[model samples]
Target: MRAVVYDTYSQDLSSLEVREVPKPKVGPGTVLVKVKAAGVNPVDWKVMAGYLDPLMDAYFPVIPGWDVAGVVEAVGFDTPEFHVGDEVMAYARKDVVQGGTFAEYVVVPAKAVALKPAELSWEQAGGLPLAGGTAQRALDTLGDLDGKTLLVHGAAGGVGSLAVQLGVARGATVLGTASEKNFDFLRGLGAVPVAYGEGVVERVLEAAGGKVDAVADFVGEQLETTLAVLADGGKHVSIADGGVAEHGGRYVWVRPDGGETARLGELAASGALKVEVAQSFGLDQVAQAFALSQSGHVRGKLVIVP
Candidate 1:
């Protein structure tokens, strides 16, 4: 199978190389999937650049992708929930081989895989796992968003966009922060759009009519500003760093949850959740995909069609 492999951390895209490697074998409790598409997240590039120090235990020569949408080619012993030829999507467990989704095929735990939404194409399905899961976790960390006023920082990005849609579905009046260009897009997702930058707190507070009931800091650097705009005792959550101590709110690190993945698929299938793949690249173009993610201005998720 051909995949993008990197030997050392470097900011240069040239460091990523396309090469052939042996196909991974499916072990017990695992399912082998023929990769149709793989979603690229900021974490993928961060890991490749050796910026994720806490994840160093996973070792090197890693594949560096967690979101996968593919068809099952085989199933290992003890895996009864899925069968050969089933179309599935998953956020592969982070502790495992960094996932092998960048190749023609990869293996993931059966518990991590779920049926993909019928309404979504492979590209859209591939983009949902990581961002969708993060959105769910961030909202869940807050007790309840229904009838509350919510603010999402960086609302035009993958996770932030999903968070806005999800918060609206949960009955929250959502205000999202994005650049002026993405304001319309955010409003289309049922969120009030506020331009991010100087005086962002004032802008958000103005949008929410003085204060918001909750704030999810998808962009960590603006944590202080987000907190200042929230109502007293409002839920504050951040996925980027330890926001618990700073804002007196919960801090979350998204984990693979088959239940959440299946629920999200149902939402997509029912037209309640929508995933946008802003860009697509071939397997050999993984370097370019990584470079695009590093730009920090992607409107939606990027996928690699292998």
Candidate 2:
């Protein structure tokens, strides 16, 4: 099978290249998926650059992706929940960083795979896992958002946009912080838009009519603002900063849960959750997609179609 591999870490995209590699063998409780699409997150390039070296060990000739939407071609022993030819998606982060989703195929644990909804295109489904899971995890830490006011720190971003939509779906009145340019995008997602720089706290207060009931901080570095705009006794969480814990807020990390990911697929399929895919690239063009993610200004998901 063909895959994009980086034999070693680099400060740039110079190491990523497509090459023919040995096919991964299915194991007990695993499934081999013929890759239809892969989602490119900033962490893909970060992992390649060794930014996550202290956290996870990497093997050479690493394939670089974690989000996938594809069809099962083979099922391993004892995996009764899925069969050959089942459509599935996953936030398939492995315990070790070796095989990845950015190839013609990938082998995943059956516990980390969920049925992909037909309502989502492969690109949309491919892009949904990591960001959708991160968004859900952050919001869940804020407790039930129903009838509450919630503020998202980076509302126009890949994860932030999904956070805004999910917060809205939970019956929260959401206020999103973005540049003035993306205010309409937030509005369409059912979030009231607040400009993020300078007087952001004041803007949020003015927009929400008071301090918000809870906060989900995606952009990080907003500890001061999060505290300033949050109601007393309100909950707060951050995916970016562990410092939030110092301030009585929770720090969230996305976990690979097939059940939660499947729930997101069902919500999206029902039009209760919508994933915005900003662009698509061929498998060979993964380096270009990584460059776009590095820009940090993309409004939605960047996907790889194999």
lDDT of 2 at 60: 88
Give the number of the best model, judged by TM-score: 2
Per-residue CA lDDT of candidate 1, range 148-182, in tens? 99999889999999999999999999999999999
Regions of model 2 farther than 4 Å from truth: none
| Location of the lowest summed lDDT over 10 successive residues in candidate 1 | 53-62
RMSD, one per candidate, in order = 1.3, 1.0
Off by over 4 Å in 1: 96-99
